[model samples]
Target chain A: MAAGGRWRQTLVGFLCLVLPLVSLWYHGRARPTPTLVERGLMRLTSPAQHAMSGVVASLSRVFTDYVWLVGVVEENRDIRRQNEVLAGLVQDREQLRKENRRLKELLRFKGERPELQTLAAQVIAKDVSPFHRVLKVALSAGADDGLERFQPVITPAGVVGHVERALGRYAEVKLAVDSDSRIATAAVGRDVKGTLVGSGDRGDFLATFETLGEAVAPGEEQRPLEAGDMLVTSGEDERYPKGLVVGHIGEGPARQSDLGWVYPVVPSVNFRTLDLVQIVTDHISTAPLDVPR
Target chain B: MSALGQSLSVILITFFLLGVESPLLQELHVSSFPPDLALVPVLWLALHVPPATGMVASLVIGLIKDGFVMGVPVGMYAEISVVTFLVARFLTSKVPIRGLSSLMITTMLLSVLASMLLALLSLLFDPAFQGHGTVLRLAGPVALVSAPFAPLVFFVLDRTDSLFARSRQRDAIFGR
Candidate 1:
């Protein structure tokens, strides 16, 4: 090999080693203080990332809209059938409306608590590694939009996850199904409370609930939690507010011998279809005087 | 084909793959185990191009991947790609992959190695990354899905190179 070629090869090989070591060192840092290099790279790459994502979003919208229109006729037929069924329930709908009004009035009797503050954000991208089961979803909202790390992200149905990383104009949310995610939850109107942990299986949205009690005593049995029971946030940790729906019990309360009972919970929010989500910013207390505990 | 042409083609292919991954693959609802299409070009370049060119292409593609795709540590994928490129370059030079079966096996082996390296890096660097066992379980499936694309990508890249060569020859003949 010529001297110049050999020198170049040596330099490239040295870089091949140094770069990965630098990356590993950066990764090992607890709170990676973004150096000038990272900051500059982020600034340069952020715009390109946003533009690429936007272009992809536009193309997908066009494809889905145009291609999916072909099924409109079949969809219309199904809608007509559903409309006929709905027509027969018109009277029932009226009765239900009256009952709903009464229930709304009764709920109003408890007054409003004003502590909860929320901001809506649109999901722009999702990063799922082929090797790892964890999902990190990026949103349009960021630090400038009052999105902070550890804030709970939710859909109308239930919790999605917490903010994992908040950047200048973008943030990454760690999905609830990620194995590292843990939520404090309880069975609604039941004494059962547990820490719900994600199972890390993509096919299964069911989280495992590890109960906070001793195993059933010898000769004495605990009431097994049945399927279809609602689980809600206990708010004991103050990370999430009380009374928000979490998920529904799926199969168990099966004894784990040493670890009390364990249950599978089907999350209320379907993460596959998530688009728009709200970030909980603050909690306000809304307790009214003379309300019975 | 000229070196510049090859480099441009590689960059274009990498960008196209990134664009497809963001919304198209996710829309297809394969976010859980999306196949690594970008690796096809890296492997192809390593097998066909000069070592220096292949290494440079691998590093560039890896940087693009880290910046654009799943937000991994900056140099993580770059290192993996370079390592894979070097290995593929070495193996092809020594053993000479002869048939489709051998090519497929080579791609699968390289994919598995890349997946394992990525998992190890994630475990070491990504503090929030959990499920070391999950990575082990997924390596095979990821390799399996990625392997089929190798032949198709190689064919396309080969065609592009031939077309570039023909164009250059035509320009030379016409004295343009």
Candidate 2:
């Protein structure tokens, strides 16, 4: 290589290494949006990336829905049995539902949760890196639609996560199963309350717990939390609504820690097939939420 | 092919791989850790291309990686990837790996190194990052899983590169 060429290469290499270091330091200082350089470069390439990811997701759907049917027969049988039982319950519930609606009409009740306004959104993209579990949601919304950043996002099944960033027509939701996610939660009927945290473990959504409220009594023999024990949002945490399902205790003995035994929580949202979610856009009052009787 | 052609080709390949890598791994039921296919292109460039070109390729690949995932700091992966590439370029220039076994070993070691660097960077950048320790614990396992994949990935990249090269070379031969 010529002297000038060698000089240019060395300078380029140095700049490449130094530039990222500078970026890391800058970002660590504060929360910021993409820099102009990053935005420009991303604009040039994002279309292609988006197209490829869409195609790949379609292919994955094929593999998941059709190619892998290992336990379909057993699953179908189990569902059929459950469906018969559910059918009976549905008939009984229909009678109760009619009576409840009639009573509500007499009382002039509008709805159970009129205070909490929400807009629906569908999952458009998922963060490809396992470490960063962010989902891109295509909102049926606009800036003036009462949607804002850091609002609680949920599905009918349970809590999906919270909106980390909200732009026009789209928002980024940080999953409840991500290591960075934290939610205030309590055991459904037990005195146990704790902060739910995701471990970001592979294969499943297994999160850890930190005891927060009243401690277990000293004298009595305490039963270790077991599998399928339910947890719900305590409403103590400002981020999510109180009483929303967070997760359930996982299939393992409660993990013992200095504070007490903390069990693994299996999040209620089926992240693998998470198709739609609702963002709780309207801010709630400071007064404790009253669950309808 | 010219320098720009090779560079553009590598960039596109990296982007596509980043998009599909996780889903493919999930389909394969390899949930323990994702095999680092991103490393393959950088490795190939390091081994085959000139140092300046390799460095540029690594930087571009790193930037793509930074853009590939959300919730991760933009420059974290970019810096780690560039550093990893520099190390690979330096080592290969010194010792010069020949066979698949050697390639596999180098890849495995580099994978571990990159993971450790990633953990360290995460710790520095994210105050709430609880997964750095977990990342450290899983580094060996991830490296072991990723090592065998290196040779196969390299083979595909090599075959693809040579296929185009052969077509170009045929024109030269016919003209000569």
Candidate 3:
């Protein structure tokens, strides 16, 4: 090729490559909507993402464990100061006590029938993804302790996620808030029931109700779901047990569709660096349609 | 100082500013975040190095990062690092990197550009990618992180430049 022609060819080649990228930029910038291609890309990149997640999880675990020493002192001082500052908190404690009692009753209700071994783990990480919110945790015991995959995980805050990947000493819990995680959840109050789907972003999940008359107010809290709401497994789907805390209702608008109520949930799992987590090893079910009472 | 020493100075200073300070600022959970550590290092390299050279450095660093902790595609960082290097190089030469305010402003602009580029690539290729907050959330953080660290990085680079006046070409190529 002539020098001029070669230069022209180079320019065209560059444009050919850059044009679609520009187009993609425009498309991505226009809206954060995912397309079929994007979904395929996510799946294709899952292994790499998973591996990176493990490295980060391990590193973060080490970082947090070491930091905990200094954190204990700061925490103690903060707690002591709060105790002195809010001494009158005891008067209001009565109402909190009653609420706590009711919550414990509910837990006992759910825990009584579970056939699997349960281990409680503390949250050590928060969601790292700016887009999809998934939580990972460190187990007090690993497979050596009989922890297995697909076990239902929970927190008093709510249904966090399940074990996505595991090793002999460590396992990764995929938070319910992950865009890929879907659960058949029901809004027990007002007889409004629907399928709760994770939206990846907190306050963005879809609670699709089939009933046409159901009403939801978007951005309004229908109820006082605390920062730590108990999420129990609803065995309706048979994938999980009868009452594992799935997630809590986060801040967002509840849409009242002619069909159902969709409430966006704020996941309770601290996804950044989960320190401790509980695994329910024996709760997987074969049936998919049984509704939980 | 030797050529290797100059290059080492640049990468070391950049790494310290980015890997350490960026996360610390994020932990502070401040409303307006500053420039990130990664962006700061990438920007510094782009300004001081040639495009081709910067591109190679970006690819190497990005691959190392993929091996390190990021939960994204393997080649994604390599691609982004090159683009960021080119953009910063273009902006620094065409605009100005002489004054602190100009440097800060340029760094801020470059950080935003890098963020937008990463965000775009992420949405396209990373299925599990959930955007942090809007650009608004990142801007404050970027400004906060990069502003204070800019002088420190510049000072180190300048000292290394004087120390290795003989091997200036290597320093230029390596962004030391």
Candidate 4:
């Protein structure tokens, strides 16, 4: 019995040291992929996570619906007042609609992007690490739902992240504000282009743009990038489509890096309140842009 | 309690805590930092359980957490948690920790150490991990947040242990 116990102790000790080292080595490699064990574990745990999220969401809905009903009377009165005002604006709205249709016809505008295929998904869970921020969010849809890894997630506001991993009925999205996340972006209607990387602070989903190109020549006059400058996807990497709203630039003390220039940007999407998002599944190719490489 | 019973209880508690930490506790973010409720139970297990059991419990809890949380490597939290459990176990054995104050102090130190280990490991393994600045900013608040909950966690776990003990005694006396 004593000998058996000693051997078991030795085995356990060996495993304790070996398991973590193996995991570290596997995860440390560039473009690390989840192992079979990881996938199995994800498959096993996803249902539980889904169930927990469902319960919490249900409770929140119940509480909000029942507790906040007291304001319904006042809200109804306010809605009635708003309805009266809206009635007066119906004629103006009809006129504007006619004008908008005429303008669209003149410009030969297609209703929406026919090339891009998108599917809507709901966020199920978020990262708990306060220090790391919400580097990832769990989504309700997964491989079974036509979600694929590296597919970009977005909202009406702007870019959210890409699908990092897709299991049976669940997927993990690597949020745009994660320290590891990078997106190719450019200033709208400007020559400025850079890669946006997350600034790992919580409640502050600010990203810093690492500009690409030669520095401004000494004593050469150059227009400075300013706050509220709209940013859009450059499609240089071919990951995200061009002209998708990325974010707006924020004013900060000018900083320079070997990359060229760095500026802070406020992401267009408010990550904190992300309930629903769209995943870009496929897009038809268009004519490529000429580049001076 | 039987060993199996204790292990099951620990596993159940850890799972529930994992659920709470991610989706539930995250919603109650106070001042940008939510208390790591999972760590509280981990500390309790390490301090109160036998060495082998504690180690197993720590690994199980850590792996479960890794699966649910994102951005970090799979073994990062598990490794840190195992180290924390070992250190806590060693210290408790060497020095008798009495009173709620001492326990709370120990909890704070362990929390800080765990956070630092996480930061260090990220720096070593994750190429995208920036630096120790985020860890430094969060360590104090996380430790402070976890400290107040130590006593509560300890009390609940202690009660659980006692309940199991009592039931076992009753079973033995009844000779089922």
Candidate 3 lDDT at A146 equals 53
Model 3: lDDT of residue B65: 37
Relative to the real complex, the DockQ score for model 1 comes to 0.41
Tens digit per residue, CA lDDT, model 3, A1-293? 67986676456435433543543444333222333433333333333344444555556545644444343566587675565446536635865786577557546734754554666554333333343444434455334545455567765445656765444334456666655566655443333334556565444333222222334454543542322232344466655666444555555655655454455555445544334455666654532322332
State in Å the error of residue A210, model 1: 1.9
- lDDT over C-alpha atoms for residue B131 of model 2: 78
TM-score of 1: 0.76
| Candidate of highest DockQ | 4
Report i-RMS for every model: 3.0, 3.0, 8.4, 2.3
In angstroms, the error of model 2 at B77 is 1.3
| Model 1 chain A lowest lDDT segment of ten | A284-293
TM-score of 4: 0.82
Which regions of candidate 2 are displaced past 4 Å? Answer: A29-50, A57-114, A124-127, A130-132, A140-149, A165-171, A189-192, A213-229, A255-261, A286-293, B26-32, B163-176
Residue lDDT tens for model 3, B5-33: 44456665554443333234335443134
Residue range B7-53, candidate 2, lDDT tens digits: 66777777777766644554555545677777777887777667778
True contacts kept of each: 0.44, 0.46, 0.01, 0.48
Best by TM-score: 4
lDDT of 1 by residue, A1-293 (tens): 89999889778867875686587667545452444544455555555556676787677655644444444567596776576557547746885887576446434422343455766566666664743332333444343455566788776677787776555555566677778778887777666777778876677766877777643444557545778878777776567777667788886545464566677789988877666666777865332212111
Model 2 alpha-carbon miss at residue A287, Å: 9.4
lDDT comparing candidate 4 with the true structure: 0.70
